[model samples]
Target: DQQVKQNSPSLSVQEGRISILNCDYTNSMFDYFLWYKKYPAEGPTFLISISSIKDKNEDGRFTVFLNKSAKHLSLHIVPSQPGDSAVYFCAARTFSGGGADGLTFGKGTHLIIQP
Candidate 1:
């Protein structure tokens, strides 16, 4: 079973608009949440992350929000641009889960920016 889930397979938005991507998780033991953006044939690149203790985190045009009680998380991108089009994956892990290779990942959402 997938602990992390991204229900929406894709989203499209106009340039300079905001893009929102959502994710859900089933594991309460997951204490860390992360979002990664990937281009075709390239590795997923770290985007933003939020800890269980924090409700939200932001960096430049990207932000991540976490609702522990609902077991939900979301990623928001402001001023969406054509270059921002990519596949975004939501991931989660426990601090003590052991090893650096352990992360439960969602299938990913493809974001398309229209000019």
Candidate 2:
């Protein structure tokens, strides 16, 4: 069974607007989560992240929020720009090992920013 899921296959937002992406996980073992943004023919790059202990984390225009009790997390981008149009993947992992083997990623959600 897929432990992490992004229910929405795609999301469209107007430029200069706010974009919100949602993710859900069923595994309680997951203690840390990350959001990765990927462009066409390019590898995913780390965008924002939030730990289970914190409810929110922000980095400039990108912000991530976690609700441990609900096993849910969201990424918000304010003033969405044309360059922000890409596929966003939600990944989760336990704080066990330092390797990437423990990471679980959701089927990315494509965000389309229209100008």
Candidate 3:
């Protein structure tokens, strides 16, 4: 099954504190990984990504680290802000598709940053 699991349903963090979210996968064929941030009623926006070839990727306030051996990955947001309060989805692309690209998404993790 294409189950990309985000075990936590929500997290609350104070402003200027670090927030971490975790994800796990059951399939071994997955090759590409992505983290997408989403607001209510809007499409999930791509945040960070890493291929099977890389173990870590970072962009400004966001960092995603993948550990293939453990079948897991984590996203870290340093000094989380209220603006960061939103649902985060963990997705993966293992292969191409007919009408869509490789994308299997988790239910999502809600991150709340208190100002």
lDDT of 2 by residue, 1-115 (tens): 9999999999999999999999999999898999999998989999988888999999999999999999999999998999999999999988766654568999999999999
RMSD for all candidates, in order, please.
Answer: 1.3, 1.4, 2.0
Model 2 regions more than 4 Å off: 97-101
- Predicted candidate 3 versus true structure: per-residue lDDT over 1-115, tens digit per residue: 5479998999999999999999999888888999999999998899999998999999999999999999999999997999999999999877656543669898899999998
Local error of candidate 2 at 52, Å? 0.6
Compared with the true structure, the alpha-carbon lDDT of candidate 1 equals: 0.94
Judged by whole-model lDDT over C-alpha atoms, candidate 2 comes out at 0.94
Candidate 3 lDDT for residue 45: 92
The estimated TM-scores of all candidates read 0.95, 0.95, 0.92
Local error of candidate 3 at 105, Å? 0.5
**In candidate 3, how many Å is residue 29 off?**
0.5
When sorted by TM-score, best at the front, the candidate numbers are 1, 2, 3
